[model samples]
Target: MIELSRRALVAGAAGATVTGLLATTMTSPAAAQDAATPAGPAASPIPGAYRYKVGEARVTAISDGVRTFPMPQGFVRNASGEAVNDALAAAFLPPDQISIPFTVLLIETGRRRLLVDTGNGPGQGPVGLLAPTLAAIGVAPESIDQVVISHFHGDHINGLLTAEGTPAFPNARVFVPEAEWSFWMDDGEASRAPDRLKGNFQNVRRVFKPLDGKVERYAWNKEIAPGLVSVGTPGHTPGHTSFELGSGADALFIQSDITNIPALFVANPSWQVMLDMDGVKAAEVRRRTYDRLVADRMNVAGYHFPFPGAAHLAREGEGYRYVPVMWNPVP
Candidate 1:
């Protein structure tokens, strides 16, 4: 063997280190395969449905999915776009877009099943998932005993019919507020309705015309079903209504579109959504309803709230804060 210079010895060591790294990399077959292959498509979402109890009544919250779109210029009639963006940001929601969720409630007491406000009917983009969601939870449309509507809004009444424009709930007795029936079913009102609302008037006819002789009109302050009383909370529409369900000592307030996306209207009661037919009256109704809810410590279920939207209200600053009720895994 010949004596080596220090430079030659250093080069040999460096070469050895490179060889070791190469051998390690070559040995990792699994890693190489993982790096070579792209990830598979994401799994489908679980069926969106939840069940909980309100006293003896079993209430099921069925999600109709969400609609996300760029925020309209006049989304908030009373506030500027910049202010609306700020409010959205404060709620940890992304700016420049609005995501409105639709939730439908099904209350079962004794042998009767009453569905409150059908969601957007089938075939409407991300919406109209109510039928499938209900099916997933084993609730057949025919099993529904009564379908009590909160208002005449399309999202609230569209699901009354099927994709083929037939009654979805073939065996259910459909109930509409007397006031709502009077407003939307009036020929004078239909003729005089603004350009924007003309479509709503037409849609109301489309939905109710099929159930004409069969529709049952119920008045405010009446018991539409067992342990359920209708409460008129208008302004969002001329005849918008809410419901109070009481059993024993427990109660729940079904606030239907009283405040769309509580993150905005609930936090700022004075701010009005463009959907409000009477913006001023809607604001006033919102504040009044919220005050009573806070005072009574009532549990509330909202139609336009996120999935499984059940919460309690607390007065925060000038507005109110919605404290979501904890999810009960078992009913």
Candidate 2:
């Protein structure tokens, strides 16, 4: 098993709490004012990428950026607006608004490198950070050997193509779920899609049409790449999938949109998100997935989780609690 540690870093001085340190340091009014003012214009925050190990393989969590907005009407189909706000408040998040993050996973075995999912393409507001973050970690797009898609969601597929409508990972082979391809590629299904989903049908074509004959469709329970087995985790989409990433004895579950935002959906598994194609079925799968995670004590890496989104789950009452894994500076 991989050695997991939990060590909290102190903000300022030893034995001093952040609040206490601030109180002592800002005693003078001028000191406080001076503290707030920078000597010169500050630079923009540098985006980050995190890497750790899963057995012998190195796994990096590359951020794609985030989307923050006020909670829209019907964001949670089954829950009342008030209930949704309550959940957010319980999680210590700001009420009335939510920030959904997008993260893509890179798994590197000594022999090959694989990307789990792509992020929202470039130029998307507050997103499209995947490319830069990858570069930040010294990974070039061309070095990726395989691109494994979790589902057909725009956020997960958009990064597959570049601004020029060319394959982003020019040298990589693309693998998609067989079920997902059949559902989205069928004209009959596209024609019957409701207005809200009509755009999704068109968008699917827009992303995949350029990769025709270059794409390889995969099935459930199969190893799409070495040590990476595709697991059928439908409901978010008819062909939505997850993966069991095992290297040696260490394993991590790459949960792709199993729960959109952990605070809202993971804590309240029964509450359905607007993106779920089949809310009821999505709920069922979410519950089942969480139950397994809890029982097996498996660590998970979520696509929409906070930056470097990797954690462990514990059963809390009728739902599950998210416990983030400790960051190891050297892996």
Candidate 3:
């Protein structure tokens, strides 16, 4: 059994509360400034990045950028677009646009450097900034000894290859979820999939073909790497997974795609996403998992969350709210 220390839980809760208040206060002022100064120099706000210590390990969150698009029909299979838009509006986001931010984490555990997931590769626009971001932190791609993937989604796997379609990390071992690999590699499954989803099936092959036998498949409940244990979290994909990163008395849950956009889905765990292969099961898992998170006061890192992506979940008026941690300028 895994346990969370009382001190960590209290700290996370306090951090979440402060963050929520700060975000609420800052958003209005920022938006007003943006509207009033349209012709001002477009200087970049300090990068969305942060670092925190989880026991002996040092975790850094790097931004790969964000992609915003109209909320696709059936985006939330169980809810109407109007309802989804309402939720987005409440979060001070545009009602019609869905923004997905890509965040990758670097875990330095004294002896080893581990990268959680690679972002969409170069040629996809600013998203390929992971490589440069890593460099900015003084860690080269070659310095990463291991790459642990939660699933085979394009945004997560595309960074495995460089813009030229070659291995991005020359000296890293890739670990993929066994169930995910099996589902994607099954020709029968692909043949049976709906026309709309066949592209994902094709993408899995394209990304892994060059690696050939180099990729290692890991099972749920196993430690794919030091201090990183894979937990079975399916429905988004056959082998979709979440990770439990623990050291001593500290822990963080790496929830990759468990909720596509927290404001919309996390606030309404019963809502289903079109990307969920099994919507009903996904909702069941989401509710149960989040119930536990709320009860345990756990800190989570969401892949599609705003940059840095680390947040503390809290029960809010029959749903939940994601309160992002403050950006610590010094990492």
Candidate 4:
């Protein structure tokens, strides 16, 4: 057996070890700088890419873009902005505004190129950068073997089509939560939904219409891809799902829309978001899910987190805090 250093032994004592830890330690600072590297006029903003190895697999978080909006009244359905601001203050963020960053991960497991959730498509202001970001990382959309969607929300599924309403990933198979597909595709559900949600219903049809009979609906607790198992996380949308990606003894929870803005939602999970289809259910899921994350010391990749949204969950006073993972350049 290979000898282990005292430090390594202690860090790995829990049967968890990050691959290339030494290389990450040595190159992380430089990597952080590289993330902010200036882009040429024609090049999309430096793709905000981050890479880490999970056992033998390579996971890269590619930023689509970010959107900032004024805090809408009832942004937090159950709490006031002042109350939410306190949570934001604790996270060192502005209390009056919200910034949502979209990130999609590319997982290369030697056998497959899996993309977890496509970002907002080109129409949503500067948020549709996923395509260009992928290009910047030397990955063409067609090269992806699978496109996995966590839900049917516009921001999550709009990127499925291009500006001209074409399949963005021509060669890849698209997989989405069965419940999401069922809910969105139901005319009866759409008819009863509020006016604000009617657009989402139509948008879902527009995005999926071109791919008729091609979309694959997956259920909870199923392995949509190797090492990628879907966990039923509802309320944000009836079918919203989180993923547990395990490789050997390492794992990462892709918490898709579990919380929108970490400063507000993650820090004050009890506070409900207006975007949640079922506010009470969302809060319950958020509280219970985050509690487990804190207790288990799981790394999470949040869809709306800051760029390259990988972080460890830490228990704070009432809720929890997100500890961002340091950048690793050499991986």
TM-score of each: 0.86, 0.87, 0.85, 0.86
Model 2 worst lDDT run, 10 consecutive residues: 21-30
Model 3 per-residue lDDT tens digits across residues 78-147:
8888898899988999988888888888888876988888988776754566775554344668888888
RMSD of 1: 17.5
lDDT of all the models against the reference? 0.78, 0.79, 0.75, 0.76
The numbered model that scores best in TM-score is: 2
TM-score of 1: 0.86
lDDT winner, 1 or 4: 1
Q: 1-331, model 4: which lDDT tens digit per residue? A: 0011101000111222334323222112112222345322322233356667666667877777777788788888888778888877877888788888888888889868989988888666557777755654457788989999999887888888888989999988999999998999998999999999999998898999998866898999999898899999999999999999988877788999989998888778888889999988998999898888888887888988886688888888898888887654542
Clashes of each: 0, 0, 0, 0
177 Cα displacement, candidate 1 (Å): 0.8
Show where candidate 3 strays beyond 4 Å. 1-48
lDDT tens digits, residue span 152-222, model 2: 98999999998888888988999999999999999999999999999999999999988887799999999
Per-residue lDDT of model 1, residues 29-92, tens digit only: 1111122343233121322566667778878777776788999889999899988889889989
Candidate 3 — worst ten consecutive residues by lDDT sum? 5-14
Candidate 3 matches the true fold with a TM-score of 0.85
